[model samples]
Target: MRALIIIDVQKDFLANGFLVVPEGEKVIPVINNINHHFDVVVATKDWHPASHKSFACNHHEREVGEIVEVNDLPQILWPAHCVSNSDGAKFPEDLNTKVIEKVFEKGTKEDVDDYSGFFDNGKLNDTGLHDYLQSKGVKEVYVAGIALDFCVKYTALDAKALGYKTFMIEDASKGINFRPNDVQNAIIDMKVSGIRVIHSRELEKVFSGDY
Candidate 1:
């Protein structure tokens, strides 16, 4: 079966948000338009605690964009975003969430950061996404969402690692280019790992079973 795994489309990643990705809002319509074409659809959320170690606010005079170590893991300190039960953590009203079957919450552990929808940064914890997809008989997964360089990229990589035939929808995702060429490098990494990068338009006929 085919699945569309959407990553971190929460309010905090939108325009004027704490960790906005460039053109993140643009993916909402694209995702909405194609979600029905899939056999199943699931979403992921950041769902961080207020004091998550990845947030700069919890550190002593530390600012966003700073890198720190927690539990021997390197972490990029971002502005506190997607705090659990907060407005920032909620999906925007305009996003078509009715199509989402389940929402896997990540980064809930205050001491760890989870960039992938499937696993934490340490790869020590699983978010149950893989098993859930397995239960749904998903063999091919189409990944799209905000921040292509981070959450979206990691999710796609993990999906591939878990033996799913993975594809990344470039037109249905946006990147957080915090540094030069971060997006380009991420795409290359996925390609090296055998993940196909395609545009949403390319899937129309395939999804409709008319190809």
Candidate 2:
């Protein structure tokens, strides 16, 4: 069956919040429209801890946007965002959450930074997102929401590797920096990795009752 994966459409990613992505809130209406067309709606949230190493605040001498290697993975130091139970961590109230059957919380552990909904720092950890989706018989996934360069892009790539036919709705996503090239690069990466990248308008033709 086809599932809609909404990645980190949270208040923190909005215009006035910390770590806001440019025009991030604009994708909400598009995501809402897409959610109704799919059978299963899976939403992911960036539920990080205050001491999460991915945050620059946790690094004594590091500044935001600095790249540091952690566990052999390149980790970008971000402004403190989406700490668990904080206002920034909650999904946007404007988003229609009723249709979301499953909610996956990522980046909970202070040690690991989870950009993908399926795994933490590209590894399977405490989050049971993959198993939950498998239990629901989800085979093909259509992804949308938040920053295209980080969360959304990584999630799409990981979904493809997990043996699911993945698609990212281009128009329904926005980038962190107002960088158009990053979005274009992500589209290329998705395509080369065998993941489909299409505009939101094309979703109806691509997504039918069955995969």
Candidate 3:
């Protein structure tokens, strides 16, 4: 079976978000159009606590976009956006949530940051996504959503690492582009790591189920 992994389409990543990704809202229509193409649909959320170390405000004088060391991990400081119960953390009303069978939350651990839906940055802990997908007999995964250069890229790499055939839906994912070429570099990283990067249009014939 195949699954669609929608990564962090929360309000904070959208146009008026605290840490807005370039054209983040553009992914909504693409994802909504292709979500039902798979047998299962799952989403990921950036559920961070107020005191999470990845937030620049938590550090003495660090600013957003600065890289800091946390628990020996190189953590990129971000503007506090996805606070656990905040409005910014909630999925947008435009997202088709009814088809999402489950949602796996990440970045919950204050000590470490989690970019991938499957595991924490250190790979010390998992978000139970792998086990759930395995239980559902999903051998292939199509990943899409906000921040293509960060969360979406990491999630796709981790999906391939976990023995699943992983593909990144380019048009359905937006990039934060901290650097001008972040999105391109992310695509290179995925390709070298054995993950296919594709557009939504190509999926029609490939995943042609009655879904």
Candidate 2 off by > 4 Å: 122-126, 178-180, 208-211
* Residue 47 lDDT (model 2): 91
Q: What's each prediction's clash count?
A: 0, 0, 0
- Top candidate (lDDT): 3
Lowest lDDT 10-residue stretch of candidate 3 = 202-211
lDDT of 2 by residue, 51-136 (tens): 99999989889999898977778888999999999999888888999999878999998877998888888485846767877888
TM-score of every candidate: 0.96, 0.93, 0.97
| lDDT tens digits by residue: candidate 3, 138-191 | 999999998899999999999998899999999999998888899999999999
Ranking by TM-score: 3, 1, 2
Worst 10 residues of 1 by lDDT: 202-211
Q: Which pairs of residues clash in candidate 2, taking residues 3 or more apart in a chain or in different chains? A: none
In candidate 1, the residue pairs with backbone N, CA or C atoms under 3 Å apart (3 or more residues apart, or in different chains) clash, namely none
lDDT of 1: 0.92
